[model samples]
Target: MKDVYLFSGFLGSGKTSMLTDVIRQLKEKNLKPAVMMNELGKLPFDSQVVEKDIPLKEMLEGCICCSGAEKTEAQIQSLLLDSNFDVLIIETTGAAHPVEALDAVYSPLFADQLNVKGIVTVVDTKLWLHRQTLTPQVRSLFMEQIRHAHLLLANKMDLLTEAEQGQAVYELQGLNPHAFILQTTNGRVPLNLLEDLKATAQVAKKEIIKAPLSAMQLGSCLVEFTGKEFTQEQFEEWVRTLPDTVYRMKGYVPIEGIKNPMLFQYAYGMVQWLPEYLKMPAKLVMIGENIDTVPVIGFN
Candidate 1:
């Protein structure tokens, strides 16, 4: 098993900028590292900005925790089988929930090959208050990312007044009483502070990560159904009727006589699907206001 670190944070929380720094720091010590980036509806163009030559995997168009679990697992397997990287870092979508994503990683299939190193959550102090003021659905989604994090990184400290910084730290501690709080100007934290390394017991000297991961990205409720297969027409109709609150929905579902699990993505007020993957059983994760209240497909 190799060391695995998961970076959990909301959108615009500096996960990408921090990843570049972490990769360089890891290479400075001669460690082989790989990166997995999750983005919404597109490839992580940010990968183009990474100066390092590390191997990168893109789990695009959906959150790994809910609808994209299988794709994510497949990518992870490919990385471990094809590459010689000693460390794996997964940067989740900002809206993704950390709990479900972790479950997919620690599942029996990969448990023997991968070890849990840490769950590092980076937060932007400048936007934290603004996000908090959004609807409860949005707020839950935002707070969920930090609630169960091992470390609550209060990034962008330079933008806040001393009193504001103290208040921000207080809020984080109030949510996750056990997390280690450190203020950062731009996601500038030591990689050593991330997780314990078994190859080097000396690295275990610090105990920063301990909190467990929890369910993911907010404003969404996950809906998965496998009892019956769907006709192509039925599937399309179901997607079209999705309520307005369904901001994003994606997952795999079995199709009648198709023999392939259909992969569907709905975001930006449009829908797209690929029949090639055909990884089915219809697992959908919907992120938006009142996902539980949406009566589109009636999963409740």
Candidate 2:
């Protein structure tokens, strides 16, 4: 599976700078990497920063979390099919929400082929300190981005005084106690820091003491079995073990010994498998709260 890393931060927070450095380091290690850049501007200004050889997809004029989400899915599928890269780096617009950006990446077909490394958020320490001056909605969005990060980079530290730097660390730690925070100038983060980081979309139970179910939003991911088939017994067993949070699943599955794919659906603990006269895309969309964590459909 290819590894995926998400770059998220507010405007002028140095996400592009961080992405450049990450690409450089990956090249140093001789690993191939691809990039998907989301820009709200008419043209993707950041695309110029990525080298020509790297497989690049640009999403312009919209945030990946909202208007651009459908496009994001198509672009990712294209990259997966056309490129031969070990890592995929997605840079979202400064205004994008981390959760929605991730939602866009978890398409059922792509989820199994990609290993989500985590969201790395860059913080402009100065702006963070003066965040109270911003409008409430923007401020909340920034907070949400930071809160969901597995790795946090407090960038542009050169502008902060020693005392202010200390305060930024303290307050950021308070906001996201689970993240591994690092202070850097110009977003120069060490690759070693990312060695073992993994993102579990599920929020920790202890952290839920104050904000319960905030991470359990209703979401969906499509599962495609175009080039694969599954045994009916194993497939049913997989469905039976799924959590109650999985409210519904519907798709076509190519069952062993069956001439064509079957139309399958599940809801409220009930399962339905109907015979289909023709072969359709062996894909199903699963919907529920926190469904992004659902394991990829297996074909053993």
Candidate 3:
């Protein structure tokens, strides 16, 4: 069985920085690890930050809590089938709820093969204090991630005053009494903390089984198709016919007449294109609200 560790946090909360460090530590211990990164935009910012040798799988344009969950599970399964990794690290989008993402992994398909190691919530102490006043949705998402974490990492501690840091820790303790809390700058916590921390052995499986499907429907819908190749004109025509419910779409597409594969990203009907020199297998993930994947079968 492989340990699945979830690294979740708000925007710019240092989740990526922490993840890079964690991957380095895992490699030093001779553990084969795979990474799954969920991003809000088409840009693979975090992916570029990781070491080139590490295996990385990405789900973009949709929060993990939404249409991307199933795809995430599928990717994990594929990685497990193809490689002999000892652990899987999932770095979720800033807006995602950690619990919902965790719920997605507890599917019957993965129940016997994967174990929940611990949920690590990285917090920007300075930003978290003012988050409540910005927007209700942001606050809800932040709280959800923090509340579900088995270990809370107070990152960017240098940005906060000593008293502010203390206050934040106290508040976090109140929210989750069982979580182990630590403060660090740029997510510099000891590697031992990650290796030694474990999930509660007696967690009720029913809790995961009972989470409503609606809770998982918190983000846009998405469908991803991968194959050896796809035509650019064919992909463009398919995008033009996308439903109104579809708000965001992105992924790598292979087409003729382009030296490198083309990258397409759409948000609220606006689309952008990027030409990349390097190419990989043709894979695309589309994101939208209430998107019906059945209607887009031709693209697959």
Candidate 4:
């Protein structure tokens, strides 16, 4: 049977970094790994992180838990038939609910051929300490991700002070007493720790995800800034005025006087900019609750 590991975490919680390390470790042990990445927008930005030699399938413009349920099953089946891999790793979009994502994977079509290892969630330690600042719906989403994880990685420990880190761990342990919690920086964890993990008991009982996904109320929109270049200062100012509901935004953006577009990422109130050598589409995909209502002007 092929082992399946589901990586669940909030936006900017280091899921991709963890995935890269896991893939590298698995390769060292002579185990082939296949990846399935889900993104909330038309562009598959994160998929670029996966190397070309790895077998990768991407689902875009939707989350696997709801709109892409059927597609998720199809992709899994495709990977099983076409790839010679010992393990399959699924990286769900940040907005995905853990229960619904597992529900999508429990399809009977090829259930007998797969063994679900466990859900490994990456928690941003500093973000958890300040989760109360988020909207009630988003905060509930964040807690649900932690509450359902079988193995939790409290990531980004470097950003937290000793006192704050202790408080975060205490609360995370209280939320998930059954799971093993590891404090990590950059989502680093020992691979041996994952070898014996079994899917949570909650996964064995699948009734929880039967409710309609509309109840979650998350949304996303893709804004293409094709042919437009903005001054770096202008773009940053616009981002500053956005509402708290805007959880994450990422894409290649063209900046005035720059030879190539820059890779831009925004989560919570923090923004990161990386220089990109290759020219790509100048578009941004935003994900959050009621994100469609978030305004975009001047650079359409």
* Model 2 Cα lDDT, one tens digit per residue, 46-129: 899999999999998888887676799899999988899989999999999887787667664455576666789999999999
Cα miss at 88, model 3 (Å)? Answer: 0.7
Separate clash counts for every candidate? 14, 1, 0, 0
Pitting candidate 1 against candidate 4, the one with the higher lDDT is: 4
lDDT score of model 4? 0.79
lDDT of 1 by residue, 1-300 (tens): 678888889888898888888888898899988988888867668777655578888877788887787788788888888888988989888888776665445432344466656568899888886775678886787787787576778999999899999999998888877567779977887877775322111111112121122321123334545456777677778767766745565666567787766776676478787885534445555544334445644332
Alpha carbon lDDT of each predicted model: 0.68, 0.79, 0.68, 0.79
Tens-place lDDT per residue, model 4, 1-300, is 888889999999999999999999999999999999999999999999898889999999988988797799899989988999999999999999876676666544455467767778999999899999999999999998998787899999999889998999999999877678999998897888887775522111212111111212233445656577888788999999899977666677899999888888776788999998887656565655445456676756
Candidate numbers, best TM-score first, in rank order: 2, 4, 3, 1
Poorest stretch of ten by lDDT in candidate 2: 203-212
TM-score of each: 0.65, 0.72, 0.66, 0.67
Query: On residues 173-216, what C-alpha lDDT tens digit does candidate 3 reach at each position?
Result: 88867678998888866778876655522122222111111211
Query: What lDDT would candidate 2 get against the real structure?
Result: 0.79
Give candidate 2 regions above 4 Å deviation. Answer: 200-300
- For model 3, name the residue pairs that clash: none
Stretches off by above 4 angstroms in model 4 are: 200-300
